[model samples]
Target: MEAIANGLILLMLSIGHAELWTSVINRTHALKIHEVYLKRLRHVLELLMVLFPLVLLFAVGLSDPGVLVGGEWSQLPLWWQPILLLCTLGFLGLIYSGVRHQFYRPPRQQTAQESELIHLRERLKQDLIGEGPYHYLAGLPFNEIFSVEFTRKTFQLSRLPEKWEGLTILHLSDLHFSGTLKREYFIELCRIAQEMKPDLIIFAGDLIDRMECLDWLQETLGPMQAPLGRFFILGNHDWNQESLQIRQTLSETGWIDLTAEPVRLQHEGQTLFMAGTEAPWMGKLQDVKLSEDNAADDFLLLVSHTPDNFHWAEREGYDLVLSGHTHGGQVRVPPFGPIFAPSLHGTRYTSGTFFRGSTLLHVSRGVSGIHPLRWFCRPEISLLTLHSADKK
Candidate 1:
């Protein structure tokens, strides 16, 4: 009976591994060496599939006291069982390594599809900027609007007044301010923000993507002055040592870094609580200060680099949560939506506004790119308006 169970487990494991391999091949762009890798993967799978049944048979046949464990090992086929077991374990390890290699690790070389995508992006850039092939990529200064009216309940609960209800919250995130992000574009983005006359401005993590470009970003960011106070939070990218240097530069030049912390604001006689969470999803709220005297009354607004804590904010009775990191799946399909949404929730609420009861979760598509291309989803800056209860 034990032998049968072990055999069944092995069979199931074989099937599962095969499925995983199939999925990886289907999703990833094929390379020249992919065929060789595929053959090795298939060989490993076949070995497991073939050995599982044989191992089962051996275990059953050796069930009697004449087997190794039964002290009648001399009469049993001892070598075959040990050999099969060793082979199975080794093959399993190979499969595991393959899966890990394909998903977790970066690709050694760009696939044909990736190369094509780059070319396509270059073409689009040439067309958009009216430049030659090697003119260098310049930032296109464009305004991205993400305006939404608030519910009546939102205004009634918070004393922000009916007239000022439609106040805009300008949001920027994941500004990979390095090779591609030109100095002019940063100033233009800040100018646009100023021109829009936003009631509040929020920098939701990752002010710069590369550390080497910190000086350039700082030069651009220095001239950016908004009417409302600007608040910033640390992103996962910013936590890196290189990014820390950029953060220090920003810190020196009037950019506030809120790490798992919340600050209270009194705008137009309304109390607003803005909190930021430390990223990478440790499931703990950092830097968020809750006032014990009147925790419930504060119109709590939370910012996280990743939208992992949407449920967390909802459960904690937050009014609104702002986040980025999904980048609208960065590359979304028409009906199927984003191909890769980096979250526990997969593609659900990849970008835009989602409601967890009364709590609003706004995931920005982001301002720049790490991969240098977005298929369907364009780079964005979210503009959220706070409406009063009476206005509704």
Candidate 2:
């Protein structure tokens, strides 16, 4: 019976030791994951961490009493129990050291100037586009090509004539129109865009950053008119968890609300269908049901908040898709690119125009900041001019 008790004690101690080590290992693993970009892995590790403690509790319950007490003080030497406990505690300390060494320490830090310069460049890129004339007056940076000197971006239509080459589409995105930005900034941008005489105005989303300011925003944005029409879609930030009063305000002002719906526009004998999809982050709140058959036209444009929905847009036979929400990383790192896209697809198809099969996706950086400050990737207004292939 004594031998059996000894055997049980050893089994319990072994499991208990392993249980403690496993917990330390899990914590170390979680810490290591922070160094890498693995959101899913992080979640899994968190779940394992909780489960491991429960497993340890079960192990403790099943363990022999003497094993936990180290064969007892009376039965063995009086010092044995405390010594065994100390040894176990010492073992735990060793495991903690191993975990700390293997995981917790941060990577090497860059020099202050190097870090600052990196930050400066990122800010420069983010703030390079999306400001109006006054934003420039405020000392914003814009690429020379997108500056007033260039004024326009031309695209050659696959099959069309030279006369239609000047078909201009003014692309504005992520208005973030709230108290944060001066109301005049948007009014000034609208005035400037009106002066440009765009054939169409496409607003990708986030008309109001906060739902409370819908009335003020609608009044400010309502008068802005384009020769063709003004179109808008829903952005993730559009749906404030409060009541959706913004949606009602936009509808009242004749803002062609395209949240999860399709609108067809006919101009100069060519038909173009504009479709908007549900914001991916919204899950079931998205309510778009467009098919290519429904958009049987010369051109199809899909407007979305995030670009990961491009596959669906392409499959639906969209000629182009315009989106925002990357903010060009809102701060970028040279060569490394934007920090992220805010989509499950990572940084793919973020903050620029990309060709996906026959579909063209233009991911605008945005017009305003959630905060007035911009570091690298500034706000932008995109002037897209479509050129007919026949002209050239």
Off by over 4 Å in 2: 1-151, 159-163, 241-243, 282-297, 390-392
Off by over 4 Å in 1: 1-164, 281-286, 390-392
Cα lDDT of model 2 by residue, 7-47, tens digit? 55444444344434434433332221322334455456457
Evaluated with lDDT, which candidate comes out highest? 2
lDDT of 1: 0.55
Model 2: lowest-lDDT 10 consecutive positions: 108-117
How well does candidate 1 match the true structure in TM-score terms? 0.60
lDDT agreement with native, every candidate: 0.55, 0.56
Provide the RMSD of all predictions against the true structure, rounded to 1 decimal.
13.6, 15.1
Q: Weakest 10 consecutive residues, lDDT, candidate 1? A: 109-118
